[model samples]
Target chain A: MTVKELAEKMNLKIFCGETNLDRTIEGCYVSDLLSDVMGNAKSGMAWITLQTHQNVAAIASLKDLSCIILVKGFEPEEDTLQHAVEEEIPVLGTSQQTFETAGQVYQLIC
Target chain B: MVFEYPVQGGDFTNAGTVSSKVKKMMRQLGVDAGVIKRTIVALYEAEVNIVAHAYKGVITVQLDSDKIYIKLDDEGPGIPDINQAMQRGYSTASPEVREMGFGAGMGLPNIKANSDVLEVHSVVGKGTTVEITNNF
Candidate 1:
């Protein structure tokens, strides 16, 4: 499923990178630790994290992650949005907590 | 090709800039996707280590046909125990750095896991230098 489809299915808000909503989703990873995601998260995965920093977007872009899902009603910082838009990776948001949101994304993609 | 990038400690705003630039260079050089991914992970970890711990540092990357070599030399309060630092959960990062979701003590381990060869050198009250090699 594309990120756009998954977002609709899970009710994720599109914060930025609207141009990249069509990117295909290969898997999902839930983690707030940047190094954990950097070391382990695979390309094309939708990274679910509470981190709203600019480095999160840099890591997502460097790892070629399909998109980022900011959990628990967290919002991206201004720099975060800038990097996401620059990298063409979607920064998605949801009021759902990490576990629930990850579970839902896993169900849809896996 | 050899490239150098300077890293400033406590500069979270610019973390990963070097890694991104190196990733782009590898892409343009037509390095394999798998190699590029591993290299980015290792390189970014090293870059962040410098930013989170060092006063000043320089990352020198050497790209050759067989492998890519990266050396990060930093001036800081060097790791007293390299073995302990290599452990997954050990970290000496300040609280401020931890709040940024870094200093989880995974940086060195990540570099080890992703790179084919890794070596670290440090002296207390002096600095640390990490050498990583990822084969293409």
Candidate 2:
């Protein structure tokens, strides 16, 4: 499914990078650790994390992930949103915590 | 081609800038996707190590047809036991750094997993140098 589809299905908020919401989601990786995401996340996966920093956006771009889904109603920091805008990698949000969000995302995409 | 970028210790904001640039370069050069991914992962880990541990550092990237060689030389309190540092879950990062989702002791292991060759040299009071090479 594409990012747009997943957002619609899961009621995720698109904080930035709306232009690239059409990007396809190949899978999902749920991790709060930066190194874990960096080491294990695959390209085209939707990254679910509590990390709201600009470094999260940087890792999403470097790893070529489809989008970042902030869990538990967390919003991206200002600079994080700015970087997401610049890189065109969607920074998404949801009110649900990591576990619920990850389960739902897996069901939708898998 | 060779490219060098400077890294400031504790500069978390700009940690992955160099790796981003190098990823773009590799993409433009039509490097294999898998090769590019591995190189970026390894390079990024090394780059963040400098920002997290060293006082300052320089990252040198040498791209060739067959392989990419990256060397990170830093000035700081160097690792006293390279072997111990290489083990998973061994980190000396400050609490502040850990709060940012790093220092889980996976940096060097991640680097080793992504790169074909990894070399580490350090002196306790002096500094550390990490060399990573990945064949394309």
Candidate 3:
């Protein structure tokens, strides 16, 4: 599924990079722990989590994830946003819980 | 390119910066994806532990044709039990650290999983040294 479709399906707000919404998502990982997400989420996969921190962007960069979806409408710190912009990681915000977003992504990708 | 990061203690905000820089350097160096990724993940988790729990430390990264060598040295309270600390989900991080998407006790384990070679040495009340080499 494309990032745009996942956003619409999960009712997410585009914090940045609405242009790449049509990019295809290859996999999904739901985790707040950076270690687990990196170990489990393969590159080019979408990471769904409630974490919004600089470390999250750092992890995304290291893990080479396609994008990050912040569930439950969580707001990231300004530094986190800046880092995401610097690292070129597309970030999405959603009012849905982590499980809900996972379900939506599972339907689309799996 | 060679890189070195001075990790300050208790500064969760700056945690993982070294690993992040290493990620970019690996990409710029035209290293393969898996090798670049494995090194970054290994080094970053160790760096986070330094920032969160240790007194202070420095991380040095050197890239070569065959391997990326990373060394992390810190003056924090050393691990008393290497066997126990290596366990997944075993963390001494404070609650505040947990709230920041860390302290889930996966730092050491993750580092080991990502590196081709891993070695750790520590003395209680002294410090720790973590050396990781990821082969390309």
**What are the TM-scores, per candidate, against the unseen true structure?**
0.97, 0.98, 0.93
Q: Mind listing the fnat for each candidate?
A: 0.94, 0.94, 0.85
lDDT over C-alpha atoms for residue B105 of model 1 = 88
RMSD of model 1 against the true structure: 1.0
Query: Scoring model 3 with DockQ, what do you get?
Result: 0.75
Local accuracy of candidate 2 as per-residue lDDT tens digits, B1-136: 9999999999999999999999999999999999999999999999999999999999999999989999999999999999999999999999999999999999999999999999999999999999999998
Docking quality tier of model 3: medium
Please tell me which predicted candidate would have the highest TM-score against the true structure: 2
Please give the lDDT score for candidate 3: 0.84
What's the best-to-worst order under lDDT?
Answer: 2, 1, 3
DockQ of 1: 0.91
Off by over 4 Å in 3: A19-22
* Runs of candidate 2 exceeding 4 Å displacement: none
After the best TM-score superposition of candidate 2, give how far the Cα of residue B66 lies from its true spot, in angstroms: 1.5
lDDT of 1 by residue, A8-87 (tens): 99888999988888999998888889999999899999999999999999999999999999999999999889888988
CA lDDT of B126 in candidate 3?
Answer: 89
Pairs with steric clashes in candidate 2: none
In model 3, the number of clashes is 1
